[model samples]
Target: MTEITTAQPRSLTTALDIPRPPDLSWYVQARQPVGYEVNLTRGLLNPDNPALARSVGADGYTSVRTLVVVDKVVDGLYGKALRAYFDAWRVDARWKVMPGDEDTKNLEQAVEVTAAMTEMGILRRTEKVVVVGGGVLMDVVGLAASLYRRGAPYVRVPTTLVGQVDAGVGVKTGVNHGTHKNRLGTYFAPEITLIDPEFLRTVEPRHIANGLAEIIKMALIKDASLFRLLEETVAGIDGDALADCGPAMGEVVSRAIAGMLDELEPNLWEWVLERSVDYGHTFSPSLELRADPPLLHGEAVAVDMAVCVALAVGRGLLSQADAERALGLMVAARLPIAHPVFTPELLEVGLADAVKHRDGLQRLPLTNGIGDCVFVNDVTGDELRRALEFVHAYAGTRDGVRDGS
Candidate 1:
C-alpha cells in the first residue's frame, strides 16, 4: 500500500522552444535599484504578506505609517498566523484596524486610507510598513507609503496570484480615480517583495486566472515560447505549481518586469513613461476610467488588448492570421476577449480620456509583428472608434466573432 504525501509540490512538463539564450545580465543592476529585505517562510502559510520583518532576524525599525487593515480572512495576514510572526519576533506594535471598510481597487478609497494613516502619524519616513492582503492592499498601502514622509520603506507579501506576477513585481503602485485605474500613483519600488506560495493555496480560482492574464500579456508581447508554455499547461497545473513560478517561469518574467520598470525608473514623474504605452493600455485604461465603479485594472487591460489587436489589423500592423493566433490563445485560456457590457458611449469616453491624458509628444507602442511591435501616437479617432465598436460587438456575441478580431 502506498500513500501520496499531502505536502509535495505539484509539477508539469511542457517544453518551450526558446530561440535565444536569455541574457542573465539584463537582471543585474549597475547599482542595485535599492537594498531589499525579503522573508520567505517554509511549511507554515501565514496571512500577512510582509514576511521580511520577521525574517530580518533582529527587531528592525518600526514603521512610522503602518497601513493596517482589519482582515478577518483566516487565510490572510489579518488572521492568526501573522500574530505568530509577531510572536516569533516578540516585537510590540501600535496598529489599528477599521472594520466594515469595503476593499476596492479604487483610488478614492486609497486617498481616504492614506489620509487616515497620515492623520494618525502612523506613516513616516525612516520607518517601514507591512501590507497584508492581495493586490488592493498593496496598491493602497504602497501608495500611502510613498506619500507619507514623501516616501517610506515598505515590504510586500503578495497574497494573490495577480499581485505576485504583475503588481507585486513592478515598481508601479497607485489608486484609481473615478473609473480610471492607477490614475493616481508613483514609481516607488518596495524595500522587499516576499512570495509565500503557501498563501496561494487559499486563493480563489478566478483571481488566479486574472493573474495569469497579466502573465500572458507579458509573454505574448515579448516571447512566443513563454506564451506557448502558458497556453499548453495553465489549466491542468495545480495552484501551488502556478505560485511556484519561482522555479517554473519566475526568471524570464522578472527580467521583463525589470525591463519594463527600468524604462520608467529614469522618468518616475511619467514625463517619458507614456513612451511605453504599448497599444493595449490606451483602450484598457480608458475602459477602466469609463467604468462607473472602475473595472478591475487587469480586466480592463484584457479588454484593451482586444481593442488593440483589432487596430493592429486595421493599421496593417498585424496580419489577420497572426492576430487570430493571439486571440485563439487568449480564448483557450478563457480570458475575456471583449467587454460584454461595453457601450459606444463608454468606448468613446475611454478613448478620449486616453488621448487627453497623454502628451502629443509621441505615439505609444503597438504590436506590428511577432517579437516586435511599434509605437506611433498617430492613432486616429476614426480608427480608434472602429476598434471600440468591434470590441463592443465581439464581447456581446452580437456577431459571434469576438475572438476573430
Candidate 2:
C-alpha cells in the first residue's frame, strides 16, 4: 500500500474593512426606435408595381437581391406570376418552396430554411428574405431569419386571412416543439408586413372564419367599436365578401390589424405583465397542441376566448347577457365557441403550463367587460373548472339551436 499523504490546502482570505467608494453603478438606457410598417395594398406581386421594391428599400442595394421562402400552396397559386415579376424588376431572387402545414412548422423546417438562405449567400444587412404564405409559413420563415447570423432583416407578405389580420402583423416568430405550440420562438419584428387583402380571395371559407376568431379576440379585448362592427357585419364576412372588398369585410381586416398593433406596440417584448393581447393565448396553446386531428390556431383561440368569457361572467366581470352576445357573434361568424378537448383536467394542466410561461403566476387576461381586459393572478382552480363547465354547456345549447334540436 502506498503511503497516502494529505496536503493541507491554504486559504487566502481578505476582508475589505476600509471604506471604498462603490464603483459607479447605473443602467445605460437605450431607446431604440424599432417599428415596422403594415402596408395594406393590392397587387403587391405585380411586376409593374413598386410596392414590394420600395417597402424593402430595394434601390438601396447596388444589386437588389431577394431570397424568398414560399409555402407550396401559395407557390402553386401565384408562383409563376411572382417569378415573372421578380425577373421583370431585374431583382435577383432565389426561391424555395415548402409545405406550410402545422405538422411541418417546426425547428427542423427552420433549420432547413436557414440552410437554404446560407446556400443563397444571404446578405444579412442588405438582401431581404421575403416570406409569402399563411401563418405557419410566416412563423417558420421568421424563425429561420431570426436565427441566421443572430438576425437578418426580412419582409412578410401574408397570403391568408389569419396571416394578414393576426399572425402577419406581429413580431412573434415561433415554431412548435414536441407538444407545445410556439415553444421555440423569438420576438423579431419584420422590416415590413405587406398585407394584401386580395390574398383572402384565395383562402377557403373555413380559413376566413379562422381569421375572424382572432379579429373577435381583438374586438373583445381592446376595441368596443370594433366589436360592434363585427357583431353588426358578421353576415357579410364570408370569402366572397372579402374578395369583393366589401365594406364590412374591409373594416374587419383593418380594425383587427390596427387593434392588434395598438396592443403590441407598447409592450413589444412583453416586459409588462398586464397584456390584453394574451386574452386568448394562455389556454389556447395547450388546446391547440393536444387536440387530435388538431385545431387550427385561431380555432383553438376562439374556444379559449369562449372559456374566458365564461370565466369573466362567473367572476361578475362581464355581464351574462354580454357573454351570450359575444358567443352569438362567434356563432354568427362560424367560429368554434367550444371544443370537445377542453376538459376540466386539461384546463388544470393547461393553466399550470401557462403559469410557467407567465412567470410563476397565472397572468390570465379576462374581460372586465367586452372590449376591456384585466389580468388576474389569483384565479382559483375552481373558477377555471366552473368556467370550463359553463362554456361546454353553453356551446352545447348553441349547437342545439344550430341543429334545430
Candidate 3:
C-alpha cells in the first residue's frame, strides 16, 4: 500500500528554477597554436656547418636516435656526405630511401614510410623523422609522420627547388589517393624546415622548370616585384644559376619563400576557402594525374595557369598583354603551357571537384592583375571550353615559331 503511490517527476526548468533554452547541447572550444622555423643556409650537410646538427638537437645525448628518410636519387648522390655529417654530429640516424617522383606519391608510399618508422622504434616525442628530398618525398614522409602514433615530430630538408620554395614551406602533407591528387592528407607542420640551394645543383633542368611554375604562381597572385624579377631573369634562370646563389636568383628564392610563407602562415588550415594561392591548382590536379607520360606537378600547374590566364582575360580581370606576358614567362622558363589530356571534359570534372573542395562554391581564383587575385563563384562549362581553346591556340602559335616553320 505504501509503494502503490507514484511521485511526479520535476521539470528541468522547475528543478533549477531557471529557464531552459530550446537547444540541449554543450559547446567545446580549443586552439592548437602552430609554429615552426624555415631556415635557409648554404652547405647544410657540411660537417663544419652547425645548422643541420643544431636542428637535430643532439647536445646532451651521446647519440640521438633519428630516422632520416631521403629520396633514392638524393641518397645516391649525397649518401656519403649525409653519413659523414651525422657521424660528425654523433647522431644515430637510420636511413630510409624512397623514390621521389609523382608516381611514388601515394598511400602505399606513405605506409612504407610509416612502416620504416615503426621498424626504427621511433621515440614519439624525443626523436624526429628527417625527410630529405623533393616535394613528393616530403609530402609522403610528412603524411607518414602525421599518421605514426597519431602525430610525430619531423624535419624537412628539401633538396629540390620545388621543395625549397613551395612544398617544403607549407604545412600540408598528402599522398595521392586513386586518381585524385592529394586526396588523403593532413595539415601537419614539421619541427623545422632546412633549405639549402646547393642541393638544387644536382636537380635536372626539367625539374627546375617544375619549381619555377610554383614561383611564377606566387608572383602572379601576390608579388608584382617578384614577377618583374622573374621576367628580367627568365632567360638566365636555371638550376645551375640558382645553385650559384647569385643575387638575382637569390632574391627570387627569398621572395618566393617569403611570398609563400606570407600566404600560408595566415591561413594554415585554410579556414577561409577563397585562397588566392589556389590560382593554378583548380584544374591542375586532374591534368597531373591523367597525363600519359605523367607531366611533372609544376608542368601541369603551368598548363592550368595558362588556361586561367585566358579565363582572366575573358573576364576582363587581367589584360591581354599581361596574360601574354605571363604565358611568355612560362615558355621562357621552359614550362609547358598545354597538354593533350587537359580537355574540356577534364576541366569540367576538375572544376566540379574543386567546387566540392572549396565548399559548395567555385571560389575560383583569377589573377585580377599582376600580383593581385580575385575569386569568382560562377564559372560555366562554356567559359572553361573557351579558355581551353585560347590556351591551345597560344601553345600552337608558340610551338610553330619555336619550330621555325
TM-score of each: 0.73, 0.89, 0.92
lDDT of 3 by residue, 1-405 (tens): 466868899987798776456655577999999999999999998887988877777763478879999999999999999999999889999989889988888999999999999999989888989999999999999999999999999999999888999999999999888889999999999989999999988999989999999999999999999999999999998778999989999999999999999988889999999898898999999988877777888988898899899999999999989989999999999998887778899999999999999999999999999999999999899999999888888888784112211
Between candidates 1 and 2, the TM-score winner:
2
Better of 1 and 2 by lDDT: 2
- Candidate 2 ranges with C-alpha deviation above 4 Å: 1-31, 59-63, 400-405
Steric clashes per prediction = 12, 0, 0
Clashing residue pairs found in predicted model 2: none
Instruction: Give the clashing residue pairs of candidate 3, or none.
Output: none
Task: State the weakest 10-residue window (summed lDDT) of model 2.
Answer: 11-20
Candidate 3 TM-score, C-alpha based: 0.92
In model 1, the Cα lDDT at residue 36 comes to 45
Which RMSD does model 3 reach against the true structure? 4.6
Which candidate gets the maximum lDDT versus the true structure? 3
Best-to-worst TM-score order:
3, 2, 1
Q: What lDDT score belongs to each candidate, Candidate 1 first?
A: 0.59, 0.85, 0.90
Please provide, for model 2 over 204-322, each residue's C-alpha lDDT reduced to its tens digit, 9 standing for 90 to 100: 98788888888899999888989998888888777767767767777877888888898898899888767888888888888888777777888788888888999999989999899
How good is model 1 by TM-score? 0.73
